[model samples]
Target: MANHKSALKRARQSEEKRMRNRTVKTRIKNVVKEVRSAVAEGAKDTAAQDLNKAKSIIAKAAKKGVIHRKTASRKISRLAKHVNTLTA
Candidate 1:
C-alpha cells in the first residue's frame, strides 16, 4: 500500500506502464515464434515475411523502451540469420 499521495499516483502509473510493456512483449514473442515456425517448416518466403514483421515489431518495442535497443537488434539479427539459411 502506498501511504503518501504521490506514492499512490506513482504506483498507478507504474501499473499502467507494466501492462503496456507486457502487451508489447507478448506481441514480440508471438511474432518471433511465427518466424521460427515458418523457418522450421522450410517456408522461405513465409519466413522472410514473418521475419520482416518481427523486426518491425521488435524495433518498435525497443523504440518504446519496452526492450533494450541492442537486445532488439540481436533478436532481429538472429531471426534474419535463420531466414537467410533457407537461401543458402
Candidate 2:
C-alpha cells in the first residue's frame, strides 16, 4: 500500500496508465492477428490492405509512446515482407 498521499496519487496514476496501455496493446495484437490471418488465408490484397491499416495504427501507437518507434518499424517491416512474399 502507498503510505504517503503523494505515493497514493502516483499509484492511482500508474494504475490508470496500466489499464490504458493494456487496451492499446490488446488493440495492437488484434490488428496484427488480422493481418496474419489475411496473409495465412492467401488473400494478398486483403493482407496488403490490412498491413496498411496496421502500419498506421502501429505508427500512431509508437508516436503516443505506447510502443517503441523501432519496434513499430520492425513489426511493419516484417508484416510488409510477408505480404510481399505473396506477390513474388
Candidate 3:
C-alpha cells in the first residue's frame, strides 16, 4: 500500500527491476545447465562453447548487480573445472 505518489512510482520501478532480474537469473541457470549436460554427454567442444556463454552471462549479471562478483567468479571457476575434468 504505497499512499505517496513517489512511493507508488518507486514500487512500480521495483517490480520492473525484479522481473528483469528474474529473467537474467533464469537465463544464467539455463546456460549453466546446458554446459553441464554437454559435459555429461562427453561433448567437449560444445561444453566449452556453452561454458564461454555461461561465463559471459554470469559476469554480466554480476556487473548488473543481480549477483555478487565473487559468486560469479566462483561459478565460472567451478564450471571451468568441470569442463576441464571432462577433457582430462
- CA error at residue 79 for candidate 3, angstroms: 0.5
Best by lDDT: 3
- Write down the TM-score for model 2: 0.96
* Regions of candidate 1 where Cα sits further than 4 Å from its true position: none
In order, what lDDT does every prediction score?
A: 0.96, 0.93, 0.97
Model 1: ten consecutive residues of lowest lDDT: 44-53
How many Å off is the CA of 71 in candidate 2? 0.8
Put down candidate 2 lDDT per residue, 1-88, tens digits, no spaces.
Answer: 9999999999999999999988988988999999999989999889989999999999989998999999999999998998888899
TM-score preference between candidates 1 and 2, better one: 1
TM-score of each: 0.98, 0.96, 0.96
Error of model 3, residue 21, in angstroms: 0.5
Of the candidates numbered 1 and 3, which has the greater lDDT value?
A: 3
Worst 10 residues of 3 by lDDT: 79-88
Candidate 3 structure quality by residue, lDDT tens digits, 1-88: 8999999999999999999999999999999999999999999999999999999999999999999999999999999999999868
Candidate 2 contains a number of clashing pairs equal to 0
